[model samples]
Target: IYLPYTGTTIGSFGYVPMEQMEGGKAYAASDLYSLGTTCFHLLTNVHPWDLWKKQGYRWVNSWRKHLKQPVSEQLWWIMDRLLPESYQHRYQSVDQVLEVLEFQSATPANPSQSTSKYHESFLNFLTSLRQNDQLKKQVMMGGVSLLSLGLITQGYGYFRYQTFPSNLSFLIAGLPSSTYLKTTLNGHTNSVRSIAVSPDSQYLVSGSNDHTVKIWDLPKGELVRTLNGHDGNVYSVAITPDGETIASGGDDNTIKIWNLKTGELKNNLTGHQGFISSVAISSDGKTLVSGSYDHTIKVWDLPTGKLKQTLTGETNWVSSVVISPDGKTLVSGNGGNTIRIWDLDTGNLKKTLTGHRDSVVSLIISPDGKTLFSSSLDRNIKIWDLTIGELKNTLTGHIYYVHSLAISPDGKTLVSGSANNTIKVWNVETGELKNTLTGHTNWVSSLAISPDGKTLVSGSRDDSIKLWKLP
Candidate 1:
């Protein structure tokens, strides 16, 4: 009888008596049904019966049915519990529903508890706004009232501290010194084909020939989760800026997105004519870029799995692709011994970078986009003045083909993995050999640097991924 317009029925927490109440027991199924009704109302901004009138609710009749975008699995699961049909099949107790909502467990607050305090104060402020004119007046007057001055001042201080600066001033300074740190992750069963560090450097993602991507928590050195879907060797993996989703490309000719935390496969994006050799995610994580042996680079709408555009022309395989830190530029290397830069927004070819005598295997761009580094089968890594598309310097020392390359976060150290089974670190400023890391028993296929510029990771054909500490 107490159904308010706010989408919740306070009196019918879970049910109503068949006689006295409008409904029966407030079981899990009944709760689920109510939830579905409530959700439909929230989504369409109309009443549940209104959707039924137009048959729009038919699309949401089952839990398995796919709905429109923006609904997360967690939310979907909650809706199912809230709108079940059968009272017996529905959650019998609030505890059951609470379990699904992850409210079954409780823990003490943190030592500081400032976040808790802030949240409590926020709720009080919101409630007071309705009845306490003193608070409302304070808000209307730019939060300047004697009655609320202290709370307002504290809230303002908290808000100011919580507002992160536009950029970390330290990151703008360029790559930190190469001081190698070691990491240990255990999960992959076969040769690791690729490794990509998260932008924040907190998570490390690796794709393996074993047909899985292993996500690892860094610094602490623990396996977080394994992403499984690809049928063939996983060649590349890229984590979006938000760190909630992971995009992986592989020999399966498909790219799959995974929920990083839940380790669930979101969707399979398929269209490549051949094995996808490389993948990169835009800064916003809304678009995905991939290259394949099919001799094409494709951009995709990450949310809808739609192909945005395809760049074609390579007579040979496209090996590696890197989206510049700014997300506006894309650089791709191909078996044709050339690299091309594209304006991602317009899908227009910006410049063709050429000079390598052999197939270009890998490419990386400095944070500032001022320098481009590429490794090629010609046993050399070349630096380019990206502003003018001119070769700045050719770094040579590897006795065998260079297969993978990575630049330090500061752009001062460049490291390359080679078929010679060695990882070479170089001085970007002087083009001098800094260190030769030897440990791999087979061809080194992929390399990555930690965000702190303190660790280097290399994947080899011997079915092992090793970590090298930089000095």
Candidate 2:
């Protein structure tokens, strides 16, 4: 479980400062201690305490021989740092610890080689020490001889270290244009702010600032149904994956759930106090998340317009919200330039990511729920390490504010729309700029990709949405 102020310790026993340990006043190293102990448990299915009995407690020993799984050396180093008996010897900061874990070591050691290296080094050093008394002269000669050999070995190793190969990691390649098709539906008087394609891709639903939501017959680009209810601008819209119901939230501080077949409003969720900024329906279709300028995010039951939970504490307006594909976690972005993660079952704040410089306008979680993509008025998109809530990298290319973002179904490509009237696609793994779609005449307001990951649709301030065939 995630703790509040109590820091995480990393050792056989979760040792927090005696004072802070109570009511959970733990140090960050406490997490490290837990990690090390957990590592030991995962490796042997035996608790660290069971390995060695200590004073009314169990301590883990045989630190070198026990852990046999495929783990990075840097992580082992961190585990050691955390399990130190004295806090002074433990990792002082998370950054320092992460640096070691992230440091690209020159070689990927095989388990046998790693074990041999450790044992050989230890034996060599011990042998040299055993001969220390008899002949001080021999000791001096041995020291000089070993020093010269060590320098030569290091110099050669530095110059001959193997260069690791780089390989392209693409999740979804754009479909070849010769075999692809395109279609565009024209109806709304203003720019479309959000679009949701039915699971079968036969129907497309769009909401616009024109205060109307329209459903279009896909592949033919023909208007099918128009649902009108909002009194103000409609900023966002989402359709259930089953293609049965539609949910739209707007500047009116209300969310309306529509029956797709009958074009009837089933329920109007009206608890938000300010403009509705974004909305998302969980994969299970039972929960709906709505974020608003009121600085709170509300989780509601779709079938009954009842409030399930209210997530508050954002210092500024909550601009966007998304639930992971699994529906177990909720992520919300705010004008305070922060991203807060919540546990859906317990309705508790899990983490607060504070790295963005300007208002965070949009957020998209990866399909595997391992990473989060956030766009902000700061003119950059940030990829975050979700598990630890660390900023992995900042992608820069947009000359203006980034408005909307979408990740390809394969998760390798990230497409973002910007106020510069361009949609840029990026290689998410390498942070490389792939291509820029520049057909729009004004600022691009929103973006969407076909389920097959070939066609890209972008809504722009020019009051038109264009279809771009990926190259």
Candidate 3:
């Protein structure tokens, strides 16, 4: 038995068992449970607390699906035995587990060896048969005879199918090539300034310079509805994490929230004194942040549409704003070529990073919240270390201003839309250009990657949205 004292500090409470949570005595099985939880966390990159909150130990199924490599059934059984909620059901002694492992290890070599031998003998027989001329000729004649019969049968079936309707199977194989233009969505009458895909990837939303926000069915590229509330050119749009609400900001100096499902106006938040340039929603969908030409950032309560806090210190127009995945930090790009990191809870400026030679037009943080990518009017994108506030690397290839940027869900690929009428894809790890996509007749205004990372969507100033199939 083990007793956890009052002052004992655990590195991660997620690894602790339920008995420890109740501040009661624990047995050796509790320690085994903690060990198993640690193993799961290390293997699947998921926390035990999150798993418990979501579905208790049933999260093992989810973790197993996410494994990078397969594990033996014996190993899975052992892990499951260790994670039982009841101590009485878990392995009572370490010696018992070791004995089971030892027995498994000692019992498994001969079957695979015998299977390998059988396969080798079968292959040798086929080779020998191929080398024998007489046998080969006989086999070829037999195969030809069978094929002729099959062709005759297939012809009969084809004629029969012509008279009676039936379904047929067509073997179409091969994935999409490296990068190809999939389709062009045409509805926005003016320049499409911003684009966002819903969390489920079923709907796409676009804000255009024609003073309209349009929603389209993602799979068919058909216009679903047109929202006509913004009185001026709509510049920025964001979908809530839940995919139920959309927040859009534009030249009207107001942020409008719309019901994503019904396309009805939910609320109109007004506070900015100038044109709103960018808008972003927290990962939890509880807070909405907007940046405007008034040189201020406003954080609002998403549920009630009430102003929560206002942050003002930038000297020029605030062009872009993005929240970290953890929902604790906010990064903003301003027209003065500076990036500011702010404490989301306190609304205080934490650090100011400077490197761009011209206006910072776009900002995006990595999915891990460790690195930040920013695009500038200087025709370059800079990678920054968010923790230490240092410039890590600079990517240069665009001949004109870089207007928009997006990162893949896996954080391996970074895509940028530029004023040069091209989209560039880069390897995030090595800062190498992977591919340059060209189709837009004018500047590329916005870019977004679908949740599956297999589709890249670009909205260009040519008044069109193009979808690209990614490798």
Top candidate on TM-score is 3
Distance from true position, residue 255, model 3, in Å?
0.4
Residue-pair clash count for candidate 3: 0
Residue-level lDDT tens digits of model 3 in 344-389: 9999999999999777989999989999999986679999999889
Q: Cα miss at 387, model 3 (Å)? A: 1.6
lDDT of 1 by residue, 1-471 (tens): 222222333443222212113432233333335544544444445555443446432323332333333443334334543453323223443334433322211223344543556535644544455457665444333311332343333333333233211122222122333234354355676668898777677888889978889888776778888877888779898888887888899877899999887889999988888778899988778889999978899999998889999988666778899888788888999877899988998889889988997678899999787899999866789999987899989997775568898888888888888765667778999998877766565667899887777677788765676766754
Give the alpha carbon lDDT tens digit for every residue of 333-379 in model 2. 98777899999878899999887776688899887889999998667
lDDT, ranked from best to worst: 3, 2, 1
In model 3, the clashing pairs are none
Who is ahead in TM-score, 1 or 3? 3
- lDDT for 466 (candidate 3): 93
lDDT scores in order: 0.67, 0.67, 0.76
lDDT of 3 at 284: 97
The Cα RMSD in angstroms, rounded to one decimal, for candidate 1 relative to the true structure is 24.2
